[model samples]
Target: MHDIRFIREKPAFFDKALARRGLGSVALQLAELDQRRRAAQTAFQEMQAKRNEASRQIGEVKKQGGDAAAQLAEVAALKEALGTAEIQEKALGKEIDDLLMGIPNLPADDVPDGKDETANVELRRNGKPPVFSFAPLEHDAIGERLGLMDFGAAAKLSGARFVVLKGALARLERALAAFMLDLHTGENGYTEINPPFLVRDEALFGTGQLPKFGEDLFRANTGHWLIPTAEVPLTNLVQGEIVDEAQLPLRMTALTPCFRSEAGAAGRDTRGMIRQHQFSKVELVSIAHPDASAAEHERMTACAEMVLQRLGLPYRVMALCCGDMGFSAMKTYDIEVWLPGQNCYREISSCSNCGDFQARRMNARFRGAGDKGTRFVHTLNGSGLAVGRTLVAILENYQQSDGAVLVPEALRPYMGGLDRIVPHV
Candidate 1:
């Protein structure tokens, strides 16, 4: 959430920042609402003061043996007016809060100004797309040909955008998740966490996934929402908390199944596991001091890159334009892995530095030595790697001309020394 005082003092500044994201000016509207709220608050204070004075006067009149009826009536009137003013003040305050909550975070000054992903700038590319002797097949084609990925069975059991993996293919997906979690936890300074897959609305709101993207979530009948990523639970560990400066950088990792409704993503990547209702992922979250968040962001992105690096997969890092960033992120870097089957790169992870945007919403704070007050901690989250998509990349990139899939060497141990996925005959 944005600081109302900052928005009030620099309405023009915020308006310009919003414009960079292709949004129109909201400063005037916000200012007007703030003005009304201030007026209501002033009225309530005045009435409260009058009621106190009238009560004092009534007591003096009674002591002087004079009729205090008039003063008492006057006090009652002020009390009623104060009640109305209090209601008005609360309503106006809520309106301002709602508006602020709906607004996206301001883009960082260094973020390139643009309207969409097309305007994103590529920072670097790693590895090269493998060359195949014959025509390469998409992930679905290979999985289906092997008789291990069954979309028809999944659809009969559930619906579209679902798939059931069996035998080696299922094991490969599990291996990918385990490999990522071990890499992040053992080598990346991230403490592993087994977070709950279902969370409350407040947790989602703290992570900036509620009140705007509610349609994209899977709500359970028990009033809890299925997590879209482990980031939701992992990052929220500090919600409404004040951490010591000694623990300034708290790095956490988790691997879990994520559910999404994909509300607005119709007819896109529908043919494969790329866009699915449920998938497994290894998530990375960090809470850092304000001075260290930028450097931490770069380090976090590198950690995610290391996963693909170890797996020997081709990928690139993209600095998303202002309009392309998520609601809670001030700056974002999307890591897209090469998919030979689609002949293009698709997003496998997104690392973001929230710059206290989420901290403000969550009331997550840290106090420094000699500091008089607490300051919001900076929050960052990223996918170490999307497990299913990594599985997709592996199948397409490692496919043999005869339909066998070679396992990446890094995952050999996790796969019980398995080296290849031979087609089911």
Candidate 2:
């Protein structure tokens, strides 16, 4: 949510930021609505005061045994006028709020200018992509050859964009999640949380997923939304809260099954686990002091990169362009891992700094020891790593000549010391 006061004060700056996102000028319209709302509020206050004064006059006149009929009628008229003005004020306020809520957060000045991923600027590359002696197979092909990844079965059970992993493959997915959680919580200073998989509408709104991108999500019959990512729940932990400045940054992590309808994502990545209706991800969320959010964003991105580093996955960090950033992010960094089979990198995690956009929506604030007022807390969320995609990277990168996969040394303990995943008998 944007501050209307800011828009009122700096309409040009706000519109310029929106233009970078390919959005039309809305600051003028929003300012006009705000003006009308304030006018209505002023009218309401004046009418209310008039009615109070008239009532007081009526009482005084009756005390003196004089006629109060005129004052009574005037008070009644003012009462009706105030009611209409109050309604108009509320309606105009709601209109302004709706418009503000729909607008994406203004991109940070440091963000690159672009319309899509094609314009994203790569920051740095990590390990080199593994060399293959023979032709490397895609993750799906390798999994099918091992008779472990069953797409047909998943289709029968839950339709397309789904997969059923069995035997060592399934265990590998579990191991990936466990390893990510342990790494983030034990070493990265993030408190591990097990949040509800289903959330209320307010929770989604707090995270900028609802009232705009509702079609991208799945809803339960009970009216609760299936979490699209752990970011929703983890970030909302500080919703409507005001914390002490001492807790300048509160970091949390969760591994949860994410559900997405892929509403606008038709015919893209339809072949494998790359785009799935359901997948497990270890998400990281932080509530940080506004002054420190930029540094926190870098720290969070490094935490995610650490996961890929330990797995020895070749990846690159890219600073997302303004147009490619998420709805609530002022700035974002996407980590894309190398996939030899696909012969290109794919995004495995995105770390973003929301810069109080979500905090204003969630009413989350922080106060210092000597402060007389509170300020919105900056919010950040990132995928420590997507477990399914990590598994995909492992499968394609570690494929042996005989169709087996070598588990990464970092995940050996979680995999029960299993070094290799061979075809199931």
Candidate 3:
């Protein structure tokens, strides 16, 4: 999804960025394919021009009342040549697209160079881990004891890594989602969107989810994929569009159920709802002018952080190093919420700025009044908050000694102004 023109101009910088991401030597391969594609296009154009000129010559001979047989023969030969050239050009076009689609987005200049999440540098830590008097129980143990969570029922209905919340817990989950959506649309400048949970292959490709990372998705019987996040639908709204510059920064948000196959993640956080086949999330997406994307990245992260902050949850923001970033993110910031039960912090949201990477794939662009030609709009998306994970964090952080869960003040209205979840079997 990288701009081939950028690679053509500065392969060194591109390769260096890739190197920081631990993807060694992609610039040379891309440059070679780009070269071959350009050569084929030029050759095919020359042949087509020759065929057109021969056709014109045949017409001129006939008009002069002379023998046009030689000119017609030449035209026929050129047409045959053009047919082959056209085939070659089309084949090259597909090949080049495939190559570019598989490439990851280049990391931003500020992203640190590292191998894994462990190397992620913390930017800010807010609030303090709560002090518990009694033996703190994990969210599952407390929920099960209180008859609010039922994993056994979930297993019978679906499979593992799933949970069925009853009574207050179910309401709490809904409240979390409602709270997030309200924060994004009611306060933030993002438009509210309701999109399809099931999308086609082309939609995924436009959002940089396909032609790579196919294993991470759940597909229907007919090959359509369930969305892993609302980001896919929200961000692809402008695919193949030429937007007016007046609407430069198009921000949109949605609350939807995300489905994932988790093919690569095994034996990791399988005990609880940490990794599930289905979860609810409030997602934020921006179609920004290239000049404003960098600033918008920070603003978007703050918007996500505000959710945890308003909930009075302890959390920290981490700047993900190059290797830890997602395939489509040039830069990313992860918001990790405090989990008192685990005595640590866990990621509840991630915001990314993909500067023109997905725009190129989708051919999403905007016109400028100045001399500058049409330019691709930058794209950004983040979990305003993962509803399921936020629920987990809240349960653990707000647990009472007597096994009741206190609802955060912000969610009181959503929960009918209830203060605590007093469970009854």
Candidate 4:
């Protein structure tokens, strides 16, 4: 959420920022709403003060043995006026809040200006795409040939965009999650948390998922929405909390199943796990002081890159442009892993610096040791790696001519020292 004071103080600057995101000016409308709300609040306060004074006068008149009927009538009238004023004030305040909540975070100054992924700027690349002796097949074909990935069974159980991994493929997915969690929790300074997969509407709203992207989520009959990412639960750990400045940056990680309805994603990546309704992912979230969030964003991206590096997968980092960033992110870095099967790179993880956008929504703040005031904390979340996508990259990158998939050296230990997965035959 945006600070109304900022908009009031710098409406032009705010509008310009919105323009960069391909949005029209809302600062004017917001300021007008704010002004009306403030006026209503002042009127309510004035009427409340009058009512109190009138009640005091009524007491004084009664004590002096004078008729207090007029004073009592004035107090009653003031009380009714105050109620009306208060309602108006509250309504205007809600209008401003709803507008602010719908507005996407302003892009950072350094972010490139453009719309969509085509405008994203490539930052850097790690490792080289592998050269294959034979034409590489897509992950789905390879898995199906090995009799380990079954879309038919998944279709029977669930519907489209779902896959059932069996035997070694399933183990591979589990191993990827384990490896990511270990690297983030053991090596990186993130605490491992097993958060709930289903959350209430408030939780989703706190993370900027509800009220705007509700159609993208899966809501249970019990009214709980399935988490779109671990980012929701992990970041909200500090919701409505006021932590000491000493704990400026609180890092957390979780491996959980993410569910998406893909309501807006009609006919996109319909073939495989790329855009699945259910998938496992290792998510990273950080609650950092505003001053340190930029550095923390870089560190978080590096941590995600480390996963690909360790697994010997090729990938590149792309800095998302203004219009390409997520709803809650001021800036974003997407790590696109090279997929031999697709003959292109696909996003495997995205690390973003929210710059207090979500903190405001979550009401998460931090207070300095000697300061009486608290400021919203900056929140960042990234995929250490999407386990399903990582698995896809592995299957395509490490496939052998003999129809076997060599396990990445980093994941061998988790796979019970297994080096290769042969066709089930």
Candidate 5:
């Protein structure tokens, strides 16, 4: 959430930032609401003062043996007016709060200005797209041909945008997730965590996924929301918390099945796990001191890139434009892995620096040495790599003409020493 005081003090700056996201200025509307809220607050305070004075005057009249009826009536009237003002003040405050929660984080100064991904800038590329002896089939085609990925069964059980990984394919998915978790925890200094797959509304709100993107979530009948990403829970671990500055950089990683409605993603990548209702991901989150967030952002991105590097997968890092950033991200870097099947790059991970945007929403703060005040800690999250997408990359990049898939050397141990996945038949 944005600081209302900051917006009030510098409406133009806020509006200009919004403009870069292809949004019209909300500054004027917000200012009007703030003004009304202040006016209502002032009225309530004045009425409160009047009520106190009337009470004192009434007591004096009674003590002096006067009727005191007029003063009593005046006090009663003031109380009624004060109650009305209090309600108005509360309403106006809520209005302002709602508005603030809806506003996306301001793009950092370095973020490129654009309306969408078309304007994203490529930062760097790694490795090379594998040479194919024959035309590479997409992940789904490879999985289906191997008779382990069953989309028909998935659809029968859960409708569209779902798939069931059987036998070696299922093991491959699990191996990918385990590989990512081990890499992130052992090599990247991230503490491995297993978080709840279901969370509360406040948790989602704190992560900037509520009130605006609720449509993209899966809400249970019991009111708990199926997590869209492990980041939601990992980053929210410090919600409503105050930490000592000595623990400034808290890094956590989790491998979990993420559930999303994909409400607005209809018809895109409908054929494969690329756009699925449920998929596994190894997520990385960091709570860092405000001064350290920028460096942490780069470090986090590198950690994700390392996953691809170790797998020998060709990928590129993209600096997302302002308009393409997530609601909670001040800046984002998308790591797109080359898909031989698609003959192009597809996003496999997104690393973002929220720059206190989420911390403010969660009221997560840190107390430093010699500081009488607390400051919000900066939050960052990234996909160490989406497991399903990683599996897709592996299958497409390592497929042999005879339909066998060579296992990446790093994952062979997790695959029980299996070197390749061949058709069961």
Candidate 6:
């Protein structure tokens, strides 16, 4: 959340940030809300004070054994006025909070100002795109031909945007998740966590997913929302707490199944496992002090890139344009892996430094050793990598001309040292 004080002090800067994001100036609307809410609070408090003083006058009148009828009636009217003021105060406060929640985080000054992915600046490209003398098939064509990916079965079980992996394919999917978790925790210094798949409304709010984008989530029969990513649980672990400064950087990682409704994303990536209603992923979350977030963002981005590096997959890093950035991120870096089948690079991981936007919603704070006050902890999250898409990339990129798929050297042990997958048929 942008500090209201900051917005108040620099309305033009705030509006300019919004314009770059393809949004109109909200400075007037937000400032109006702030003014109205504060006005209500001031009116409410004045009336409350008046009501208390009136009651005291009535008490003194009765104690003097004089006529108290006039004073009693005045007290009743004052009580009614105070009640109305309190109601208005509560409503205006709620409206102000909703307006604040709708505003996206301000982009970092260095982020390029542009609209959409076309304007996204590529920071670096690594590993050469694979070469194929013969026509290479997409992952869906390769997997379906190998008698492994059973989209037909998936359709029967759960309709669209889902897949069923059978035999070695299913085993390979599980192995990818385990391999990612081990690498992140056992070697990358991230503490492994087993987080809840179903979280409360506040957890989503803390992660800046609620109040907007509610349509993109799956609500359960009991009203609990399914997590869109492990980032929700892992990042919210320190919600509403004051931590010691010594633990300024808290790194946590989790491998969990994420569910998204994809409500607004109807026609994009409709084929295969590129986009899905359900998928497993390894997520990395960091809670860092303000002074450390900038450096930590680079470090976090590198961690995500490491996954693709180890798998020998070609990829590039793109700094997202303002309009293409996520709601809670001040700055973002997307790692797009090269897919030979698709003949393009697709985003496989996103690392972002949210600053204190989430911490404000979560009330998550930390205190320095000798500080008199606590400060919000800056939060960061990245996909160590999306396991499902990684599998698809592997199948498509490593496909042999003869319909066999070779496993990368790093994933060989995960796949039981089997060099290649053959058709089950």
TM-score of 4: 0.97
User: How many residue pairs clash in each candidate at the backbone level?
Assistant: 0, 0, 0, 0, 0, 1
Q: Any idea how many clashes model 1 has?
A: 0
Residue lDDT tens for model 1, 1-425: 99888888999999999998888998889899999999999989988888889989988999999999998889877777788899999999999999999999999999998888999999999999999999999999999999999999999999999999999999998889888988988889999999999999999999899889999999999999999999899989999998999987999999999999999899998898999999999999999999999999999999999999999999999999998999989999999999999999999999999999999989999998777899999999999999999999999889999999999999999999999898898
Candidate 6, superposed: residue stretches over 4 Å from native: 54-74
Q: Distance (Å) between predicted and true CA of 195, model 4?
A: 0.9
Which pairs of residues collide in candidate 3? none
What would the TM-scores of all predictions be? 0.96, 0.97, 0.96, 0.97, 0.96, 0.95
Q: Which residue pairs overlap in candidate 4's backbone?
A: none
Q: Model 3, 199-318: lDDT tens per residue?
A: 988889988889787889999998889999999998889989999888878989999999999997889898888899999999999999999999999999999999999999999999
lDDT of 1: 0.93
Model 5: per-residue Cα lDDT over 16-61, one tens digit each: 9999998899988999999999999999999888888888988898
Which stretches of model 1 miss by more than 4 angstroms?
52-71
Question: Once model 2 is optimally superposed onto the true structure by TM-score, how far is the C-alpha of residue 37 displaced, in angstroms?
Answer: 1.5
Candidate 2 wrongly placed segments (more than 4 Å): 55-71
Q: Candidate 4's C-alpha lDDT?
A: 0.93
lDDT of all predictions, in order shown? 0.93, 0.95, 0.90, 0.93, 0.94, 0.91
**Candidate 2 lDDT tens digits, 11-129:** 99999999999899998999999999998999888888888889899889999999999998888777777878889999998999889999999999999999998999999999999
Highest lDDT model number: 2
Q: Write the per-residue lDDT of candidate 4 for residues 118-221, one digit (tens) a residue.
A: 99999998999999899999999999989999999999999899999999999999999999999999899899999999998888888899799999998889
Q: What is the lDDT of candidate 5?
A: 0.94
Clashing pairs in 6: 1-357
TM-score of candidate 6 versus the correct structure, residues matched by position: 0.95
